[model samples]
Target: MQTNHDHSDVTVRRDGHIAIVELARPPYNYFDETLIGHLVAVFEQLDDDASCRAIVLASQGKAFCAGADFSGGPTDPQMPRRLYRHAVRLFATRKPIVAAVHGPAIGGGAGLALVADFRVTCEAARFAVNFNRLGIHPGFGLSVTLPRLVGPQQAAMLLFTGKRIDGRKAVEIGLADVLAPDGEVLAHAVALAHDIAASAPLALMSTRATLRQGLADAVLAAVDHEASEQEWQVRTADFAEGVAATAARREAVFTGK
Candidate 1:
């Protein structure tokens, strides 16, 4: 195994033909513009490495990613726009990604997970698209990717309700590919990456490219609309109440302002 030293928040290690990219933020791998940018850089570097045929995205901590930490200061309406731009770069990378969803992937965190080609999750893992619950439109190109993975109706249900589902339910609903045992999600994800890496590298890239053709473009367009909606929604009274309610750990009382 060879360790590729890079940015602080993200790290990459090589195991034969697969590159394991890990998020170093622990407990809750909350993302921001800088973390997303580092991820895009690492993924692009992996794309240029010929020996790296597949990538496994894993995170250290109790939760895979608990979403953005909007705890302090006034919410920056433009942050999502900037972060979404960085996210587009992630979708543009030309490498197979298998995400290890060992824990919670909520809100934008779930969007990050969807950037991968496949996801391996455990029964304890939780998946949710809670942007609507946050009183904002979905960002991170989830409008296109979620529907692409699970179809329009299922995507609508998940987006509109902002419901959290377990790994078994996620697999059943097509949100995740494989369901691994608790404590072995990363191992299974790496094994899946290895399986994908076994194929001819050029052929693998070609087939993946063909399959995901125009996906990045679709995400680009979707995020534009999503960001526009979010920009306005974030200014609403309901959004304010939603954030407060979440921080208080209670159901939100939305006034529909």
Candidate 2:
């Protein structure tokens, strides 16, 4: 195993042809611009490394990622715009990725997992797109990826209700590719990555590119529309109520004012 770069928010280590890229934040692993930037850098580096053919995107925290840190720190209105710029780069990466989702992946976090080529999850994992519940349009290119994975009808159900589903249900719905035992999510993800890595590297890249043709471009376009919707929604009275209610752990009573 070769240990390459270790940053504050992410760590990149290579085992044979599979690179294990782990998010370092503990507990919830709430994302910010710094974390996203670090991830983009790591993925880009691994793309160029001939020794790394595939990746397992895992997290150290209890939750794979609970989404953005909306607990109020930066007041910058352009923050999501900046974050999506980095996120789009993730979709452009050439190597296949398998995400190990052992816990909650909510809102944009669910979007992050979709960036992977496949997701390996356990029953303990929860996946949701809670943007509508927060009175905002979904971002992180989920507007495109989610529907592409699970069809528009199921995607609409998930987006509108913001309901969380367990890993087994996610697999049944095609949101996750593999269902693993509770503690073996990461191992299962790495095993999947290894399977991809064992293939002929050049052919694998070519085949993967052919399979995901235009996906990055579609995600880029979708994010533009998503950001525009979110901008207006952020100004709504219901947005504030949604965030507050979420923090308070209560059902949000949104008035479409």
- C-alpha lDDT of all candidate models, in order: 0.92, 0.92
Q: Give the alpha carbon lDDT tens digit for every residue of 117-173 in model 2.
A: 999999999999999998888999998999999999999999999999999999999
Q: TM-score for all predictions?
A: 0.98, 0.97
Candidate 1's residue-wise lDDT over 59-135, tens digit each? 99999988888766347888888989999999999989999999999999999999999999999999999888878
Superposing all C-alpha atoms, what RMSD in Å does each candidate have to the true structure?
A: 0.9, 1.2
Clashes of each: 0, 0
Clashing pairs in 2: none
Off by over 4 Å in 2: 73-75
Candidate 2 minimal-lDDT segment of 10 residues: 70-79
